[model samples]
Target: MDFLPPLPLLIAFCGASVLLAVTPGPAVFYIITRSLAQGRRAGLASVAGVALGNLGNALGAALGLAALFAISSIAFTVVKYAGAAYLIYLGIKALRRPAEVRDAALGTADTRRIFRDGFLVALLNPKTAIFFAAFLPQFMSAHGSVVGQSLLLGATFVAIAALTDTIYATAAGTIAPRLRGNKRAGAAGRYVTASAFIGLGLFTALSGSSRAK
Candidate 1:
């Protein structure tokens, strides 16, 4: 079907997605923190939630919203700013948070909270929606069904992201307990987490979403 991206385009897209996923970003930082504080299961659950949110953005982008995003600089700017603000807010919260977690493994209530927060983290970022709108269409052909093609590409991205994110979570979870005990390390961890979030936020605010040429 024309909805399927060409072999070459698909390959390129996959490669790009892998690179993007592997490169640590706000999402990665979020997953790492959750895993470090709450263990692997929480990290995985967060991954699922984030992926679902990303898929929602992809679906929205598929429904002819890409055109609006591409044509309107104002729209892009507003969303970008909003995302940055959210990230900064998250950073501030992280900074103010207690150094110690209740336990390495989260209880059901906390796990659900992590998952819900993960979903909102991705969903609230206008950058994600604009990113799907901007990035997926480049690989699509005029002859293809836009919705189908966008969904395919978006799913691919989500899958790749989930895999990479899990790897980070697992790795972080492995060492989380060590840091969990050391009070000094715990204090340091708080700053690191806060810095990561704030840095991502500032970067997002300054860097407008411009697709690769």
Candidate 2:
């Protein structure tokens, strides 16, 4: 009975979640690329997968597993390095790929494959887990059931993420054609994607642990 967050806190949580979701990140870029290359359905599926991954992080935070991960330096380091390596690998792969091959791969990619790819990309991201652990606890009341509050917060986060991600996917889809038609623009898109992945990799590698006592 005492598990629910206050209305104002809930509103603030929702607003913050929406804003974060809209902010460009590796996940957003992946979704945009998938949607633009494949179709709207593929994009939505990718978003759903990402939502599930985020939910997993939230659940881990709610259950205190994230705290365990945060405290264990070995585990944290493993996850962090893995994420960084993957991002770098993706960036390198993007850069090496010819435009025609990239277009072919994009065009032929299946929705389910895209969904799985997005899910894995999110699941291995230590930053996402850390963010959920740090961000959700601030809005939680000590008097409330922590688990329940965590779940509510996580759900709110996912709802906002889903809505905003969909908007990005749709907008990207709408504009993809114009870029695709222009050879120079298409080349620029590839460069941007490669740079984003590399930047994210470096950022993740250099970021300090988000654990707060």
Candidate 3:
């Protein structure tokens, strides 16, 4: 299969994906919390989860489910609310947990668990599916096999996402110690994680539905 995306489109996709990856979202917040409370390894694992989840989103877009979600208000609402609820739940859980707890109760999180968390977080967001569905096709060539083009674009997206998220994890891990040593800083980190979750949930709930297909 001729899998190459058009050069310009590829560049655009890479740029957009990088921007999205770098932006602090629920995934970033979770990774930061894990890193601060546990260690670098946990944070890296969460990053892996996010990468896999993003891949799933790309797959959904390639397979046309994202388009269906975009068109169906009911389906979109269900997904949006579900995602929002999950975020809120995570936030409340984080807030209620004692500071002395280590590893974020993730049970000796390895690379697999970290990646799983990231994957589930990204995969659960219908907006990500819609994003891939709308964004990837813009760069896709009409002449090539659609599936091939999509896979290439999706892979590129995943690679960028992984790189960016890894950076976030590393940074969080590095900063975590300094923050942990200071009681006020540690408290702030916990509060920020909780706020991020609730804020993201509220944002998702209030956002107008997109009809993009």
TM-score of each model, in listed order? 0.81, 0.82, 0.83
lDDT of each: 0.75, 0.74, 0.72
Tens-digit lDDT track for model 3 on 140-192?
88988888888789878778877877787788778665654566766777778
TM-score order, best first, reads: 3, 2, 1
| Model 1 lDDT, full chain set | 0.75
User: For candidate 2, lDDT tens digit of each residue in 1-213?
Assistant: 567888788788887777777787767877787676555666888888888877877787788868878789788778777877777777787788877776654445567766776676677776677788889878877889999999889878877887888998888777665555567766777777677677767777787764210
Q: Write the per-residue lDDT of candidate 1 for residues 103-138, one digit (tens) a residue.
A: 223333266767887787776566677778878878
Q: Which stretches in model 2 have alpha-carbon errors above 4 Å?
A: 36-42, 96-100, 210-213
| C-alpha lDDT (0 to 100) for residue 100 of candidate 3 | 64
Using lDDT as the measure, name the better of candidate 1 and candidate 3: 1
Residue ranges of candidate 3 with Cα displaced over 4 Å = 23-26, 102-114, 209-213
User: Residue 110 in candidate 1 has what lDDT?
Assistant: 68
Pairs of residues clashing in candidate 3: 45-114, 46-114, 48-115, 49-115, 49-118, 49-119, 50-118, 50-119, 53-119
Among these predictions, the greatest lDDT belongs to 1
